[model samples]
Target: MFRSFPAMAFRTRCPVLDPAAFCFRPSTDLRNPETVISEPQAKVTLFEAAELLRNDEVVAIPTETVYGLAANAFSPAAITKIYATKNRPQDNPLIVHVSSLAMLEEILPDHRIPPIYLPVINRFWPGPLTIILPKSDRIPAIACNQPTVAVRFPSHPIARALITQCGFPLAAPSANSSGKPSPTIASHVISDLDTKIPLVLDGGQCYFGIESTVLDALRSPPAILRPGGVTFEALKEVLGMEELQVYKKHFVDVQLEMTPTTPGMKYRHYSPEAQVVLFEKPIPLGNGLVPTIDNTNCKGFELSTMVAMTILETDIESLRSSIAHEVEQLLSAGNRKFGILRTSSSSLQDITKNRGSTFKSSTEFTVVEKFLGSALHPEQVAHELFKCLREMDAQGMDVILVEGISEDREGLAVMNRLRKAASRIVTM
Candidate 1:
């Protein structure tokens, strides 16, 4: 059984208050970076939402990234509700959200921000970047028992306003059921968490449409635990961060996976009900021969490697052919619906438009296609990836074929999600 809740619009009027009285110390810093329009109905809704949060209840709030399931960072009970509501594992830690540097200082040991993070905070704070720092005693074990806690200062006006209104930092993770694609819009939150959570502040679609980059500057090389809205290239350009490293697919840390210090590290996340088949960029061999993958003996959920010392005239065309083969095989086994997530302008659309006519005439067949922007602009792809996945799932696709993009800028984060969501990776 599913439950429902009121998804409130986040257009509340900013009440005039004294600088000292406001939780955010600097009164001048409280204004939204974007335009601020006030509405009376939204004011009442914001107050109600804050009241619920003050009482240790979970509230879904929008951020520049994805919507977050927020609860009082200091309350273990409230934090537990977030875990129960999302069915998130206790081992997976949460990120603490703050409205101001003052609020952040309150949770830090000795009320001091680490020197190493000063440059990063200046460059990326109040945006989609999470930094892992030493946890203070005020932080509850459930939030993150580890010595370090992940914290972010969100630029979203509603999220900042809500935290300031409540007078405490919030421990929040992506506002969706665990292992599912993170919600980019309020409707996505209501669809997944609904009755599980009380209120969702609908601030419209998320600007980043992905989670914040989780950076552990405490590490020797200062590794990025998760690639997100913040790109490695951008981070590398930051002063004193030239040596930063990102944990890629090939680098496996078994201990870290089992006991993740933060979210997105230990779980199989961003997945949908339908099987996701990721088609990676083809690796060309100098020898001129077509490589063939034998799928006759492959069974359920088994990933087989296709390798050959063969050169392909057009790797992209071969990749499209390989995906078509997968679709045909599935259709022959009674799978009637398919979805294609395209990353560039290509002839892949021809498969969806023309192939159905050539399939068995008596069998019902359908194909849905969505463009995840273009590879040249990966941020656009990141923005549309999860939404398209959910839309395809809602339309009841049997399998989703996603064209993989290069690991550049936001493309790293885009491919990271697709790799986790994918059940099979077909490398040409």
Candidate 2:
């Protein structure tokens, strides 16, 4: 018979089966050609999850940004299962999730929070922000893979409650197959990790469609290794981070490729099934193909030039034409259906209007458009980005064309994710 561990006693007592390690396994090894499923694992509850964590098993839990494959940070065997289950790179590392400052302190070497991160924690903690700090011996080496461990206090009630009940931190990474889009809903987690893990706590769709921003405060001047729900502007606005630097934007650090300080720094992440092509923000041109026309100038322009200028002055129109050209080329090459992740400034109507009459007549070409929020509200754009990409892939789009936004505020994270998702880029 497969027996479930009791939540009350499980928390206080180490696994009875293993003397060297604390972990739980059924008496019968089903996958060993020995035992069959006496009982199926049910949708996990907080109590069940706490018991499971006590027994050193991995579970799927929800954070505000995405679902996570969580395991007891102290258990090497449990952490190994997470890596094997996700097929995550061994060196990629994981973020340690804490429920409170006390739990966070329990895992730190000196039990002292880094002074540089205090202000950031005051503002962004219990939200979507991850900070890097020195790794402690309490954390298994596999969890960090480097000298420092990434930590965050998740805002999700279930996530925090689970950690608090387990009486320890959880080392969690996005709950999905490696290189796949992070799971925003429990079904996404089940789809990817079914039959591998014992339980998945069904949390609804994540508030932010992307992961948390990974910031390294251990370094001088500080740096953002990955952009997600938290914006770089928010970090900069923090008292101690007024002069903070973001990797790649402020300066390129080549060493990161060889030895990544954070999880996202050395991986190809959040890619969809179809190829993505990103178009940079369109440059506004004035009449006659000159810069925006001012009342002061037009003496050198000709009537025909002005007429041409009138046809394509708007940035949205220019972007539409550029994508339409690409669509035409793809149609000639035999791609049938295409997808557009539209920005507030551009839409399907704009692209259709720009498609040449000849290209519009082609029956083979079909275009699907999804408005991914707006450039003006990058926060909403960030929220919809991954979902849009996954949905487009499901729609069988031969290729996805995305409109780029400025790298400011949440746009910084939006563009970072876009660049990674896109296989090719066409700057407008």
Candidate 3:
């Protein structure tokens, strides 16, 4: 049946799976008629997966956040390989992905489960949400550049199988090459880091092509460290919806540089090569009314190479049409060139199936459809922001304006990222 990648041999005595044994190129096959891998054989091999992981080597594993190149959290050599392969800054520590509550207890300081977090963990575990807690003495300082380390229980079976097999938390970063795009398929993994890493258990595609939501349990009422699958609204509902108190409750120290005890806390993260400019959704005053341009600072769009991003399926065209129609009416208005990265639900589904991998645990999401709807969800968008930005950026646009998503379910995840990607934030 589905066994933790059964090893052909033992770890200590087992010879490395001849790195050549793997195809440098991944199989082009996508869409497993059956969305879920109910068949035992359809799952990933775990023992071999562990052997590779233990050796301080990289293993491309799937997570709700994105496809990640993971390593033994405790091993310094393994951590270094992740940096070298992804070209990620060493100062930016990595998140530790675990399979169960037992594993978390084994690794994290066995602190009292604050009553406040109980409901949250019960609701969102084995998914994309991450809990940052006090570091266990046994943990490697490298896991968290700060005093607290970020940990998660991935819902993907293959991912859980691999992590449980490894017997240690795996420190994983998005598998794609550094600063490029986060990989969602076997090909994306291969394109970015095939030879550099050992084995990648092709587990179809990822549902949430983003990072996990990182919440700080260290705070009273709880605060979000990094946004991901779980939304702030979700957090508020579970934890007594009170206005997040600043100054006092939100006492988190932002991690930067390889500071002894935190990870993934530092760095201008989730950015694509293209410079993202945030714009106001509705026309603002002064530069207010028509023109569809925010006059407060038209300087960001002064250059003609800027592209205002919006979903092709969205009614955004009404405003766009209005802007083009009124451009002549508005004096001193500038020539704003647009490069659109529009994709319809069906077309996006096709592209996700053809290009990105499907999530093994769920079928509700696809690669392209993730950007649909409104409301900003930073975590989900963060997962694919780099990829989307990279695509538009490649076209040679000067400034990239990402259309805002409704801050609903996946939309919540999109907004956080849009806020960061857009130079200026706007609402439609």
Candidate 4:
């Protein structure tokens, strides 16, 4: 069952009195990896979460997109624990979550927002959009490795209540081990962070199963450094942003090494434990998955495909054939099990049918398949993408194959993440 902050608090902001006035609840101590906080779970009330933050202890809080490991952005000691707990690099900055514009104003250098972002903020604030702004001195250097910082105002009631109650900005990143899929539920947090943090306020599953869009309006003709819940089409609708550029395949900033303004920039993130292969084109709708065994027309591949094919056999007939051949090779090499993340347009059952009688007779074939909702409904696919990836990982599959979707609407963000997670990408 899903849960959130109180109805009264959800409707209106309520100022929480000083946490020092309340008796601090004892937090479960976890000294070993084997230690688990079961039953009543490790969920805490808004008041308790506020006290934990006041004590400079890290707690996992749910957001509209994913759970965040939150700490007082003003405290250097508290921020350091977040890095250590997630094994996150010190140089990769964290996003600051604010409850209201007033909280956002308190942290800005001039207590003013840039004029360019006013329209976007007006349209997308308190949602899944994060904006990059100049860092104020009040923000510790440890929280931002660069001169700028990323800020987000989450819409989740539990998240807003906890931040409002704490009366300070929280420096938070996805509450999972660095380089893994971000957590979308309390249990996902516990599975990865387990007693690493003091508490997890279990609001429920996230609305968008991906992270917030990291937009840098500070740049002329703003560019999307990282794609997330906010779509490119949505941002383009805002005035003065029609020429907006995406940092995905369309363009790459050579300056990223010297200036990474957002979290996903300059990092390999959202990867599962298994070796991942992504088929960039949708599996042809009507034909079976495998290509003709007759190897032909293998030249003139796309850049990613060309690079990937250098590793694959020269005789493969088509993209689908390459998939079957790769699976066979892995099976031949004694990797007996695999996993597949299918979109509505593609299916593992198709592959089984393609293999014909050989598929039934093959003793080495084992695959776990999961569907990520309809391709026509990218929103549903976006809402389930990360959680489904984590689910496949838990199944102990040796390798995971993902089907790609068109970069339209939310599919743009989906493809961006898929590119980052894939060890091999074939865009035939």
Best by TM-score: 1
For residues 1-428, could you state the per-residue lDDT of candidate 1 as single tens digits? 11233343333222322112213334346332222326556556668878988898888888889989999999887887887788887788999998888888888898888888888988887899999988989998754458889999987777877787788889999999999999998888878876576678788788889899999888877889999999999999897788999876435678877777888987799999999988886433333333233334111012222332122325555766787777778778788888889855544566666665544445667788998886667799999988999999999999888878767789899988999899898876
lDDT of 2 at 46: 60
Query: How do the candidates rank by lDDT, highest first?
Result: 1, 4, 2, 3
Error (Å) of candidate 4 at residue 46 is: 0.7
lDDT of each model, Cα atoms only? 0.77, 0.73, 0.54, 0.74
Query: Worst 10-residue stretch by lDDT in candidate 2?
Result: 14-23
Model 3 TM-score, all chains together: 0.64
CA error at residue 110 for candidate 2, angstroms? 0.8
lDDT of 4 by residue, 207-297 (tens): 8989999898888779888888999999999987888988855677778844577798878999999878887654332332233223232
Per-residue lDDT value at 222 in model 4: 91
Off by over 4 Å in 2: 1-44, 282-318, 352-363
Q: Which pairs clash in model 4?
A: none
Give me the candidate number with maximum lDDT.
1
Clash pairs, candidate 1, are none
Say which prediction, candidate 1 or candidate 2, comes out ahead on TM-score: 1
lDDT of 2 by residue, 372-409 (tens): 87566778888888778878878999888887876767
Residue-level lDDT of model 3, residues 26-77, one tens digit each, is 1221111112333343334456678878776778876656788888888776
Superposed on all Cα atoms, the candidates' RMSDs to the truth, in angstroms, are 8.3, 11.4, 13.6, 11.8
